[model samples]
Target: METKLKVGDKVTCDKFASLTHNFVGSIEKIYENSAVVEILEHHKDDTVVVSDFHNRAVVALNHMKKISA
Candidate 1:
């Protein structure tokens, strides 16, 4: 089911440790087992903005799921 989620796909993750993600973003890039989500925009998970990130946060593919249009 997770495999259906691909690069550029939008997702609504209900369980991402601390945030019930309603945020929408594209899968900027992917790897053999992970991806780099260039978080386009977030609603409330601004715990740390990308601008604040010293380095890009490449999240595990499992941490995100593709959402419908």
Candidate 2:
């Protein structure tokens, strides 16, 4: 089933394409194919990922899994 996501929802994003590691964030905006995520947590070793993206990332819906409260 498709995961229903909305703004402010916490999610875990899978590593894909140019991303080197998985990350956790909250959805800031949603688009047809992707959503803008405001990075909240990530692996300490992947600090560069957060810095490079400036703590924001546009991730595809398929790559995101909603975190249950």
Best by TM-score: 2
Top candidate when judged by lDDT against the true structure:
2
Model 2 worst lDDT window (10 residues): 14-23
lDDT, candidate 1, 1-69, per-residue tens: 336667667654333433444455677677877776666656555546545642234667666667653
lDDT of 1 at 65: 69
Instruction: Give the per-residue lDDT digits (tens) of candidate 2, residues 1-69.
Output: 286899999999997655678989999999998999998888887787688889999999998899952
C-alpha RMSD in Å of predicted model 1 compared with the true structure? 3.8
- Which residue window of length 10 is worst by lDDT in model 1? 13-22
Looking at model 2, residue 38 earns an lDDT score of 91
Candidate 1 yields a Cα-based lDDT of 0.57
Q: Tell me how many clashing residue pairs each candidate has.
A: 2, 0
